[model samples]
Target: MPPPSPPPPSLSPDLHRVLSLLPRLASPRHLLQAHAYLLPRGGHRHARVASALLLASLRLPLRDHAAALVRRVHPSVSLRAAARLRGRGGGGLAAQLHSLLVRAGHAADPHASASLVQAYCSCGSVASARRVFDETAASADVVSWNVMIDGYVKSGDLARAREMFDVMPGRNVVSWTMVIGAYAQMKQPEEAIEVFRRMQVEGIEPDGVALLSVLSACGDLGVVDLGEWVHRFVLRRGLCQEIPLMNAIIDMYVKCGSVKKALEVFEGMEQKSIVTWTTMIAGFALHGLGSEAVELFRRMEKENVSPNDITFLAVLSVCSHVGLTDLGRWYFKTMVSQYKIKPRVEHYGCMIDLLGRAGCLMEARGLVQDMPFKANAAIWGALLAAARTHGDTELGEQALLHLIELEPHNSGNYILLSNIYAEQERWDAVRELRISMRDRGLRNVPGASSIDVDGMVHEFTSRDGSHPSLHKIREVLCAINSNIKSVGHIALLPESLHDVEEG
Candidate 1:
């Protein structure tokens, strides 16, 4: 090849300008010319420019160029590029690139070491990543610890991840945020909230991500006070401008059973995404605010915001809640006819529930028969619930058959059908159902209820008498029951003495 020409005089050697040029470099000669200028200016030490060059050179299918580029850049940049490029060649190529850094004595550099650990972790070689971490633990920084914790999380090893987190030399917002998220994903929301409390005690200011994780934990635990505190912090920090964080706040309030507070936040948001609209609609559905939900949905359309599948599901739920059968049917049809969106099983469930609850059992059963996908347990469960409510023993039996086949292990399905038979005074049929349950070794799962008291949640299960205040609670409940009974009130017992005696 002839001598490479110098970079064009018009091209500035500034980092940003060089980065802009990498994408536009069409030929090997242009790349060489740019590299010639950048190399003299120590631009290769900058991770952004080096990463761009590494990516550009690889796209050009110039192995020599990529290798030479990797060697010229800082070690941290090389390992980071290697980590990103792992998708192209997997662990084998990562090992090759890591060898190059080791040969250049760059493996001992703290940032570079962290990058190497991350590269191995990204490629799913957690063992190799751990080895590198152990070797450099003395010099490792917070970034190194964060990467290792993240790798363990990605690998689905939360126990070890938490262990590492606890033993970490120090913690930052990322560290606290990650552990909080990990616990949430593990369904340990209480632990997640506890960690958030510790984080607050440590005086580390939570960023948007940290706040999001904590909000999710609060929502899961129904800790509205902490959720409100997080909301205040967001406002105090001026991070409410982020639409996602605002969305999390709405979800937290909804889950905490504060629909009014949730709506207040919803109305206050200046900018909204489809998620915001859907969350608000679902919140209204949950709280049985059908009129408000419908109005908001119509306003959403007026603003030209397209509704997705989840949006229709929320609208259908609102209709179901308030018994707007006709309106529910219209939306269900419009979801497919106007928007060209396919109906998911959940949408069909909502529609079936609406029709069944409205005493349109025949129409609901027809929809189930005509739906495109196979009916799941939830679809049958809704039908069964409606049958029970409407005293349709025949429809209840049909729904029960499907429910049993779909969910043989679920005791709730069996109990629902039995209750329907008991309502109709079909003692023989109820006895047979009880016999079937006994033969299958399925016992009715106890029902449970919960109440929140001063930021603490208390849960009770049927037949459970374990609370410290159980005696006083029962006394109060007895007095209330006696007072109501005196006013000509009667309790409709779902499980009669005969049904209970059978088992």
Candidate 2:
């Protein structure tokens, strides 16, 4: 057969340069102008320009224009465009592009097939990704298998992800990391640690990513000893060059309730990211070291590490807990006005709780009323607690109404209302509220206390006598009450108690 004629060159040098600039262009207006310049020439095969136009359209906020431009591109150019669409949250458009690739007869190409799978995964079309995996005639490569496994993991199908991992003919560090990371993300620390152990038993050395996953799992499970072992392993492997691993170690220690060890990890790091700073701040905050957290925040700013919402959350929570009302208010305003981060619901809730706990009942109530979004149960709960503390029965009742509307089935709201009435000596109101709670089938949550003894959690509910040490616990409680009464601590009995006794 005669050699196939060389395909016509689609793009000129000048036009290709202009097209290359399209992706870097700042505004949609500039892209549209570029589009206008290229739209009229039919014979001029500017394939590169066409691809750029497709991408620019997709990047624009207006979806319709991007879709139209995508349709106008030739199938080959569109396939390249589809590869670029991966990991951008473009759901429907990614599917359309995959269909276009199959129609163009490029689905058989391994690279093209893998790209399609990745795009499908990126768009959260797990079924479509699986279909592409099944239909491709080319032998599945490691990349294709990884894509499928990663898709399952990303979609939270850990069982399917594990199944895929087990069935794969070949496995690499990436594959092991995916499965291990899945377990860690799902809070199955034991499973994650077991997978790590298996990986080592198979003679596959753990990399920074794999080690970090195991450490995170250990932290979540409060397996401090295991976390310490992982820290030692990282050191022995000499993988300290990876900054993220250092950050992960710091995070694990902090989360495992070891602030001192977390600080040691932070100080030992040769370099740090914003995440490292945030982790340290969180540790201090969790330990109620508000001044230390604030100082760390200042140091982070001086080091030019910009604080994100999580950082703000840690600092603000510290302020709330320590009653640094003015500092909390300042940081909240600074985050919005200077950092340009819009306050989310959690931020608003923190502010409300801060004000409420500080006895600024009126201000907290007003803040909830003026919130940009509707107040949720947390906001109303803060307001109700504040009102009760300040002896504002009317305001407490109003807050309860809003709380009921928000969560009608929550018995705690009714309990709070009853408690407020009881505090005000409104026996009739309290009785009515209790009756209402009974009618609604709402029962108060039983009071429970938990203590950690030798790494094991022991819980005791109100009036619980099931523990083996029940007699000893009762004796201790009686002795404590006797000591308090001997110290002239008189328990106040309600006047209603006498009336009820007579009745």
Q: Which predicted model would earn the best TM-score?
A: 1
What range of 10 consecutive residues in model 2 has the weakest lDDT sum? 494-503
- Which portions of model 1 show Cα errors greater than 4 Å? 1-78, 85-106, 387-408, 421-443, 479-503
lDDT score at residue 473, model 1, on the 0-100 scale: 68
Minimal lDDT window, size 10, model 1: 494-503
Per-prediction backbone clash count: 0, 1
Candidate with maximal lDDT: 1
Badly placed stretches (over 4 Å) of model 2 are 1-79, 85-105, 136-138, 186-191, 298-309, 329-345, 370-377, 388-393, 400-503
Q: lDDT tens digits, residues 257-343, model 2?
A: 888999998988888888889889988988899999999999999888899998998988999889999999999999999999888
RMSD (CA, angstroms), candidate 1: 6.6
Cα lDDT of model 1 by residue, 240-338, tens digit: 789999999999999999998998999999999999999999888888999999999999999999999999999999999898999999999999999
lDDT at 189 for candidate 2? Answer: 76
